[model samples]
Target: MDRNLIVTMNAGSSSLRCAVFERGSDSPDPLLRLSLRGLPEAMIWERKDERSGESLEEELTPPKVDSDAQAVALAEMKDRLLAEVASERIAAFSHRVVHGGRDHTAPVIATEEVMTDLDALSPLAPSHQPHNLAVIRDLSSGFPGIPQVACFDTSFHRDLAQVDRVFALPRDLSEEGIVRYGFHGLSYDHVATALDDLAPELSGGRVVVAHLGHGVSMCALRNGISVATTMGMTALDGLPMGRRPGSLDPGVVLYLIEERGMAPAQVREMLYDRCGLLGLSGISSDMNVLIQSDAPEAREAVEFFVYRCQREIGSLTAALGGIDALVLTGGLGEHVPDIRARICGGLGWLGVEIDHGANDAGETRISAPEARVPVFMIPTDEESVLARDAETVLED
Candidate 1:
């Protein structure tokens, strides 16, 4: 029996989330071991009230309080975590770093140089990398002696063929660290493993896992191996997300640079921050809000998102010759039944059939039993996987 406590952190552009796990005595399953979770940003947020002329309680409605910066958030979270399980009980902490480049294929205990290297990949994953590294730095400061390991989101796709990873560019450019490194592996890994646990029959077949959250991507797994993925060199490359512009036309990019006089940094902000559902709808980035909104633009944005997901689903299915199971995961995929239903609305030809009652109730299996292809709602557990990885690194 394993005797260790581990922490798994999934830090994003704005929010920092964590889960605590202790290896169970009976269950060999990673999913069952996860116990405690804390989301510092999910609870706290910032917004202004029009009537008060001053900042008021946006946190309370949703009701929360905000810490000043990443460090403060980490310190507070760590303090609370310590109260739950003493620091001495924790064997190690495993963090989810977004882009590992070609060099970092496996998880590594953190070093100053590794932190700097991860920071250098910030441009590749602007929305997630910086914050991921920040959490590492913050933890390093607060828990100086505790060992920490960095597990990357891109490591799963590291084995993609060279032809699939590069653009049609010059040799020098291709060699200069500009290439595809898919993100959200920890989540995809969760889905793949869950597929084995929940339905062993589907584990060795072709499966497309859609990770729909604030940031989104679809991974095509063949025999549980990543043959292709929607996201490329950066998180901004595929699927219109909560607030990110998926793939922009090269012509449009040139127009922004040449005519709009926008610098690369400014363009980056426009794509990474101000685009996607919020930019397209002009209402809110939240999918629930968009669904409820009667505004034409909002409805249009919702339709566009669904349509885009379908398009990619078809593309990925083709790459695998055909699809066996389509798994839905992440925040919206698991909870927002309407979105999932809409995505597979006309996908009957691909053998996807949604069970209306099960979907509405957010059950684990949302697909019709008679549906040609199985559709599953496997809520991702990246944190537990990280914890398991930490345990492996420390004790194995």
Candidate 2:
């Protein structure tokens, strides 16, 4: 209700996080600082303990998650967020929308038609779009007077070279929204800003940013510009994640549809739900679990994840012309020492040497002292980015 407060929301497929930000005391710059943060229903699907040994699939339970239950879940997620920010008068609400289609490249105030346009992109991000719009719909109606902003994840790739943004298909298909649009952009931008703040020299260098979590991707940045990324077109098209299958053969998808007689819905469900670590391990999707499992599938899952990361790093390095540093961010990137080491192993040709002791201890700098390319563990702060965007966009 006042000039000092705003709400920032990051709505993922299974989880939604929110933060409240308030202006500094009489700061004429119109800048904002974080106030509070919360993650309501993170990993709503039932998950086996990651630390648990492999061959424990029986412990899995339906997390009581319904695929189409976005409306109610969003209402509850927002209610909890509002309760968390109860003391502050929220001036505006901001969200992390995965796809902005083509027009928007910056945070923009959401209008009725804008919501409709974004909704049309559900096919592009079936696992993410509905829940994203659901949060906006419920929250917008709930707080009629508060302004809502859609901060796009795809916006960051708008400046990507045309070669990196388009497909080799016909012009009509390429123009029909079937081009490359990268995701996890909000987190990557935060990585760039964090690096600039704490390690200025490294931020401008050829940097490969690994954003590993339940869902994962890698981006190659030269001076904070995205030259290439692992994910393209859809979030499902990246490195293998918890339940999402990333980068599979197009023929496999067709075989499942045409030969196996799998309906589109069933195929989508398998790709978005049953695949990845879960399908690969025949156990759980949780990284901690796969790391602990003694089963061969579990080992394969971990190996597959790290191996692809290495392969992608090479591709990203080629895009950057060379890598000067590597940043491991997001949930998995911050704490998983072995995973980070495994990924960097194949990159030895690129002159990246890891300090096992530092990495194992979760040190911010994981590279050896003599290593040419610096490796950092910077925890991404998307809420802070959203808060900054909210303040910037809502200012008079």
Candidate 3:
């Protein structure tokens, strides 16, 4: 059987997730999945074979040399993949690029010109765009002849209303692309599709999806299209994330520069790396870790996260006039029931009633039977979106 496989890569600042899907299937399942976490200092590599139902995990420490640790890991991953499946059977490589700017509103075949355009948008998404493009470059070098597809996380929100996208900045700056461009769109797209399949009735109504992972954002969808989102200009906007501060006043940046004498680079680093849950808790940024800790700071951090999510949900509900359904996705949203409960708990005014038993059991439909607004916990499948987009680019 010569299976044409599509390999999808989603790279983050300190992690990489890769999945292999057989092309041309009505609904394809990942034949093999690989994840690399805790990059640089230490690496944990895990592989799961869906066909054989086997899983393997190991820890690795890359050499202390100056070369990029993630690139080295990708090379090792390519070797393992080639060992199991011939490179000739692979059809294409798809990537989840964070910033598409204005030119890329849809998936495009990776080329020198496309890469150059994408590289210029790096400052817009400093923490993610560089890593995303680096992986694309590595795969382009390693796979040589394979078609590379660039899937944008910003594509889904490209059609947002003018009022929602523009900032209060000067017209020249907005024209230069300082407008709001929401992120985590790949995840939101997957969830929207899942909602249509799971509950077609609600899919066409007003809905709000809370993507609560390491990178957090919320979107308001009416009739399954993005109307408004919490993120603006960059991922640093919207709900607080694992490390990035969610929303901040413009004055704070000026104060850091003028009064505190912090360099622009230092401010950027603090905004992207040292804030949010870590800054709030003065500890680890992982929600799982914070949930386990008994410290007051940890408790406060979790509380602040929940509070922000609840506030955003209310804001999105208002944007939609009223929400008929609510969806929780991403890492923390899917796995952490306590967080979900706490978030929904405050949404009583919005008619979001949680069935405690259902929520605790991790059921997909967690809303109470008589609740006005239905709530669902849908696990996001971004790799599947990447694979679908890659196949489309190949067929074109």
Best by TM-score: 3
TM-score of each: 0.89, 0.88, 0.96
Q: Is candidate 1 or candidate 2 better by TM-score?
A: 1
lDDT of each: 0.81, 0.79, 0.91
Compared with the true structure, what per-residue lDDT tens digits does model 1 show for residues 196-226? 9899999899999999998999999988989
Cα RMSD, model 2 = 6.2
TM-score of 2: 0.88
The alpha-carbon deviation from the true structure for residue 71 of candidate 2, after best TM-score superposition, in angstroms, is 4.8
lDDT of 3 at 297: 99
Candidate 3 has its poorest 10 consecutive residues by lDDT at 61-70
* Alpha-carbon runs more than 4 Å astray in model 2: 25-88
Name the candidate, 1 or 3, with the larger lDDT value.
3
TM-score-superior candidate, 2 or 3: 3
Per residue, candidate 3 scores C-alpha lDDT tens digits across 1-396 of 463999899888878888999876665569888988887777788999867889999987763578787777777777777877788888899999999999899999989999999999999899889888988888889778888899999999999999999998899999988898898999999999999999999999999999999999999999889999999888999888899999999899999999999999999999999999999999988999999999999999999999999999999999899999999999998999999999999999999999999999999999999999999999999999999999888888
By TM-score: ranked, best first:
3, 1, 2
Query: What's the true lDDT of residue 180 in model 2?
Result: 91
Number of the predicted model whose lDDT against the real structure is largest: 3
Model 1, residue 304: distance off in Å is 0.2
Residue pairs in collision within model 3: 180-233
